[model samples]
Target chain A: MRRSALTSTLTFYLPLWAFLVLLLFPFYWMLVTAVRPNKELYNLSLNQLWTSHPTLQHFQKLLFATHFAPWLQNTMLIALGATVLALSCAVFAAYAVQRLRFRGSGVIGVAIFLSYLVPPVILFIPLARIINELGLWDRPAALILTYPTFLIPFATWLLMGYFKSIPVELEDCARIDGATRVQVLRHILLPLALPGILSALIFSFTLSWNEYLYALVFLSSTGSKTIPVGLATELITGDVFQWGPLMAGALLGSVPVALIYSFFVEHYVAGLTGALKE
Target chain B: MPSVQVTTAARVVRPAGLVGRVLENHHALGVMMVTPALLILAIFLAYPFGLGVWLSFTNATIGQAGRFVGLGNFRYLLGDSVFRVVVLNTTLYAAAAVVCKLVLGFLLALLVNREFRGKRIVRAIMLLPWIVPTSLSALVFYWIYDPTFSIITWALRRIGLLHGFINYLGDPNLARASLIAANIWRGIPFFAIGLLAGLQTVSPTLYEAAAIDGAGPWQKFWFVTWPVLLPLTVVVTVFSTIMTVGDFQLIWIITHGGPANATHLFGTLAYQRAIQGGFIGEGAAISAFVLPVLVGAVMVSFHYLRRE
Candidate 1:
């Protein structure tokens, strides 16, 4: 029994610990490097694992001395705008495809799923020209408008799965009672599918917030940049990497999504696996 | 009484006209409901996609829309040595990263599937790598792989494992390995969680039955667990493969296809040629080159999904 216990520790516990460290060490490093003093950060003699004195100086500089605030604002505005736009469209579309049972609904569902497979890399090049032609170059409206290309497909697909899970009888009964289609959706279907809607909303928000390539391609000016693009481009001038403030920006940039994930991780996972399962 | 009845009838008839009839029609309502999404997709996705294909046939630059030169851009790319390297690198990167992620992630799923203390917390913490913006995490990696002051180098030297600093991103081979490593790091969480969900669906009774048939752990897993997980595995693998192949942000941030253009995937190459270099036609061709592979993957998934 003792030998078996020892073997289990070696085989399972040790490896699990190692995987956790390997997976999470970067985040811990981000936190440590963000707070460590610049002198100690560069000092080879000092302990690099942890800081003797932690400071908020880097956060202050990241917020005050750079375009980080505007970037944050821009990311927030764009993410929220895209989420709202995508969710409203997805809710109605998902309801229609999953519940309305119109002709060609199955084909529409499959097409939407296939559209999710279309990666942004393939589309970004032509999208650049289109954005320019539309006079939305370097504008948040450009992303606000374009993000739905990816977002709506995914949101619609996911919400379709959710709508499938809700019983059709509820809506049928409500319709029999003289509920208009909109009234049925508003009262019966929407209430039961609240979890799914929340999942779609959170997923859309995070996906838009985390979107890098389009943001990188579409927005050029400093004032218009999102957090990812801004931190990547503006923080490092030439070869001199600002490790401190950059890490600070990364930490700050990740916090909102992290907070949202912590709260709604179950929904998030449901959204991810739910679509796949269906 | 006749006037009042006529007014009520008028009120009823007004709503039952064209607008109400349209609203009551399921087909019309479905079309109406799907229009906004379809409109957005048509303008942004479908239109641009077609335009992208058209652009590849031309020699269009950023400002000037050049006349169509059929097959010229593709012919030029086929001859280019750098383009060839990009094709090799992208394939290798996706294949290596997906294989590693699946193996490690399956083991992780197995480990986490067991009853352990603080399991919920561990699972949540495991997802952080995937949940965070990949660009930001890649920046952390960029810092970790710094030439002079890398923590990895410092730790290795202190432990007497090395004498000189290893330039993680300087050498061509090392840079490719580094990028793949970072990709695997970010991607493992997705696979682990996905496979964990699959693992949960397996019944403990099946394992017990396998054991009753005189099976060992490996046999039990092979006979019982593997079958259940296979479908989910195929699905997640296809999804990850597509994402990995089209991956741009991580490589772009880390190396920008540097060290003699060793790390340029199709996405980065397209960006370099089309956006940065302003050879819109060439870039479009480069980006569109991967369409066949993506379509093939989608077809396979569709087939599998249909069978399921």
Candidate 2:
């Protein structure tokens, strides 16, 4: 038994630890670098692993000096706007397609799925032109509107799976008991599908928060840029790299989505696998 | 006779007004419900796709419109050496990164599936790389790969494993490898967690049956785990392929297709040409090349989904 335990530890624990380190080292490095003093950051003699004197100067500078605060506000605004819009649309559409049994629902379902396959890479150029034509250039509303192009399909598909799992008998019983179709949806389907809807909300918010190319292409001004675009484009000036402030920005930028994911991880995993399982 | 009379009476007492009648009609209600989503998609997705294809056939610049040039953009791209290099780099990048992620991610799934202390926390931590914004994590990689004062270089030197600083992003070949490594790092959590979900669905009795039949570990996996994992693998693979192949953010942040544009994917190339260089037609054409591949992936996934 002891021998077997030793073998298992060697086989499992060691490799797992190595993988964890490799996967997480960057975040650790980001944290360390974010806190390290500029004096020690440039001083090659100091150990890179730990800091003798850790500081919050970088975070203070990021919040006070740069456009980081505005960028955060912009990112939050866009992500929330996009998530709300996408979830509302997706809920109605998924309900219609999954439960309504209307004509051509299958075709619509397939089309929505196909739309998810259309990556932003293919559409960003023309989208740039579209945004320009709509007079939304350098505006957060551009991302708010266009982000749903991707988000709706995903949210709709995931919610469809959730709606499918809920028993149709519940809706049928509600319909028979003097409930109108809209009333049935509001009272029965929506309540039971609340968990699914919450997951979709979280997923959409995180995705919108992480979105880059669209923000980069659509918003050009410093004040209008999102977190990803602001940090990447505005942080560095010419040849100078501000490692401390940049890492601080990265760490701060990741915190919101990371926090949300930690709370709803099970739902997040279920939503991910649920969509594919369908 | 009474039941038939009652049904006839109920039919006559139908929903009160036009609004109620419309809501009662499945076709009308469904159309109404779907209109908002379809409107957004039509205006944003479907229209832009067609516009993109049309723009690819013209010589349109950022400010000035151009007459249709038929196949001029495609013809020019076919002749351009940089475009050719981009095509190769994107293909190599996607193919290599997806394969590596599959292998390593599966290994990770297997490891994480075993019962362990702190398994929940470990699983949650594993997904951090994926949950973090790509651009942010890519910045961390950019710093890690810095020519001067790279922690990687410091650590390696301290271990006596190296004598000289490695220019990870300066050399063309090394830069490509660096970008792929970063992509795989960001991608593995997705596959590992996905496959782990699939792993949990397998029945323990199947493994017991295999063990009772004298099957070894490899044999049991081949006979039991492989079949169960195959469908999820195909789905996750196609999904990852679509995202990875059309990737822009990582490349944009880490290299910006730099060191003489050695790392330009279709997305980055399109941005460079159309958005930055003002050659909208050429950029549209560059991005349009990815459509056929996307269609092919969608078709494959659909076929698999339909089969099940």
Provide the global lDDT of candidate 1 against the true structure: 0.92
Stretches > 4 Å off in candidate 2: B1-15
lDDT string, candidate 2, A1-278, tens digits? 99999999899999899889989999999999999999999887778899989999999999999999899999999999999999999999999999999999999998999999999998999889899999999998999999999999999999999999999999887776777899888999999999999999999999999999999999998998999999999986768759999999999999999999999998988888787677
- Reference-based TM-score, model 1: 0.96
Question: Which digits, one per residue and each the tens of the lDDT, describe model 1 over residues A179-231?
Answer: 77878889998998899999989989999999999999999999999999999
Residue pairs whose backbone atoms clash in candidate 1: none
* Interface RMSD (Å), every candidate: 1.9, 1.5
Q: Which one is best on DockQ?
A: 2
Off by over 4 Å in 1: B1-15
- Model 1 preserves the real interface contacts to a fraction of 0.76
* Cα lDDT listed for each candidate: 0.92, 0.93
The digit string of per-residue lDDT tens for model 1 on B15-117 reads: 4768778887889999999999989998999989999999999999999998899999999999999999999998899999999999999999999999989
Give the CA lDDT, 0 to 100, for residue A145 in model 2: 100
